[model samples]
Target: MNSLIYRALVELIQGLAVLMVIAYVMTRIPSFGDLLNRRLSLTHRVILGLVFGLMSIFGTLSSVDIFGGLANFRDLGPAIAGLLAGPVAGGMAGLIGGAHRYSLGGLTAEPCSVATFLAGLIGGFFYLCKKGRPIRIREVTAVMAGITLLHVLVITPLMLGLSNEIRQILKAVLLPMLLVNCAGVALFFFILQNLHRERLNEAEKHRIDSELRIAREIQMGMLPAPSRTGDPRYAVHAVLKPAKEVGGDLYHFFVRDENRICLAVGDVAGKGISASLHMAITQKLLKALAQSGEEPAGLLERLNRELCDGNETMTFVTLLVAFIDLRSGEAVLGNGGHNPPYWIRRGDVSRLVLEPGLALGIREQAVYTNQRLCLKPGDTLFLYTDGVTEAMNAHKELFGDDRLKTALLRVREKDPEAICRGIMEDLAHFVGQSEPSDDITMLVLRLESKEDAAAGAADGC
Candidate 1:
């Protein structure tokens, strides 16, 4: 073996072995294990990603110069991020590491950057393949081994377009890098597996479940009760099903100024507690803004600004708002990165044409425009979250928009209550025995005739 290869391999192995020992000790510490066992908040999760990114930076800065090219563990941070935080955070760590590597110009800079990014991305892809469960050792080993292969096959070869330089670089660093990364990942995960196991306390689990149940109750309580709206000139029926104990889907209705009825539905960027909290904030801001009697477009603008203000988590919500004239049934609708609603007009279903605004909290300066339409008696306006159309079945199929349109046409002649129930029934049947993949929400609005209102009253709509 060449002296350079021998030195690189020995140094890398020593460094990685020390790192593994330190990590193992940290996990063995009760305080550190306690911290690890706690459920991470959004801020903590973001910090975790940043920590991994920092690790990537460290890997680059501490690289060993072998002849001309540097042998580095730069991709390790991103790969670990992918294993722990899923795709987005893993990809972010890769970008951070890649950006730093690119800043330091070298023959291998571009390929190393690409290799680092893929390491994180592919690691995350494997993490998601397990569907939110703890990944098996085989998968982790496979990811680590794959990273080693990527470094040798792609990163080393692409260091120089010339074969002589590429071969020299590969001979020096390829095997060392592979050996350290694969062994390091296995040892690190061996420590982490214990931490994951320590979090399985039944009492702690029950406490979390109880808290989530209370939160779900409070969230459900915040939704509008159509029966309490005081005006029955129009009929509105809505449904919401969260994929978790708490979800980020929103649907609300309120009688504004005794004439206009504001109907709205929204979906936050993600699900679970963080998203649920974000939805609550959006709901409060929305209700407060809508009470000022603003038009749908203007209301969204104000809501967007409010959401963007001091938003550290960078969460976003896609909303659709409609203000309907109680007497004339004239409706003005505005959208922000949400699924465009379908207008069911007696036997015909049409997707409404509206300016698709950006989701709120994305940017403070987003513009919004309104689309106007009239709802005649017997015509129903249907609004929903993506969960309805993207609902999955046991066979890994989505209940797509085509199915939604077809299903709507079949029940177009029914009342708002019946229409809501019928579509939900179809969705449930289509998704039988399969886990819900997301938060689902649906709202139906109809301009009720006098006879229709009387029937609605009797049916407790």
Candidate 2:
């Protein structure tokens, strides 16, 4: 009796390991996992039922003998199959496993097989009423314990003829079987719940990543195309590098009329998708106001009013708008809590001082003023967000105003594109191995006399 009990325990443990492997295969394979869904077709459910039934048959064949009957952990696969896949699958698994047990031709075969079938039926009834709610461990354990008790009682009548042997088998094996099956079912579900949750998390992450990629492309497309302009007097170039998958920095330029070109550089506070959305709103408002031919100061004031009306987030934007007269080298610029822009003339670089005001969306009736600057032939104007000066290095040192001024001096007299490229290279070289913490936006515009422009065109400059 002691040896038989030990063998039954060994079988239970081995069957548990096999169940784990089967669970892994079901979870790792997409098609098999789908078979466990409540909405599966009848045909697919039957197939899954057959698979679990075979698993139970394997368990029964691997079981140990006790008196006139087998002591097997065959109850686990069918009961769990029914709980997971509903009544039909569970019932089918029970039938298959019970038939296999009966084939061994034991005195208790009929009663054992009946108990197995009833176990599947009971489990299936529990699953039917679950209504997609999670099956708790305590609930499963209770149900499995009831089934084991029923199994023990059902075989008692068949063992009436062999009373003394029945007493020994029941005393030795019944309690162990009851404990093993109950614990096994609970353990299987605990593992299944964890694996299911992990797969869901991974799927959510992949979905968000894909959406962000599409959003990045859409945000980039919103920027004005630098190649669309054919204005001779204005040579313009701009670059924006986001610190994250998406950013708040924006640069837009458009030729308003034959002799006027409007451009704006903006930095929306905060970062990532929220900031990017506000940046888009700012650009749209600015473009609409720009079309009205408002001067820099007027345009900035109007934009500020619009942004403040529904500003629930309390977010603000630092903006610089400049309208240049292509024919006269005259530029009217406005500043809204933005960084000072640099004016590069001939081979010298200097900062263009402007009257500062509160950032947009900060005050309801904030006023702004325009500053005037005259661009000389072959003169380039550089504009940037605070990200350029505040960029950090490996040593936590900032790429300050001094470094930016010096870099511009090196690229003086170059075309707008070359000037922008040189500044970026210098910034990159200075900040090696340091991750960017903000969005970097830069724009360079060069004005030239009609004769110099014509000459440069002839020389491919």
RMSD each, Å: 19.4, 5.1
Candidate 2 has its poorest 10 consecutive residues by lDDT at 452-461
Candidate 2 lDDT over residue span 350-385, tens digit each: 998788888999998999998887666678889999
Worst 10 residues of 1 by lDDT: 452-461
Off by over 4 Å in 1: 1-200, 226-230, 451-461
lDDT of each: 0.82, 0.82
List candidate 2 segments past 4 Å from native.
1-18, 37-43, 57-72, 99-110, 125-142, 155-168, 171-176, 190-218, 241-245, 291-294, 349-356, 365-367, 387-414, 418-436, 452-461
Q: After TM-score superposition, what is the CA distance of residue 150 in candidate 2 from its true location, in Å?
A: 1.8
Model 1 residue pairs with clashes: none
Candidate 2 whole-model C-alpha lDDT, 0 to 1: 0.82
Q: Model 2, 267: alpha-carbon shift in Å? A: 1.5
Candidate with the greatest TM-score versus the true structure: 2
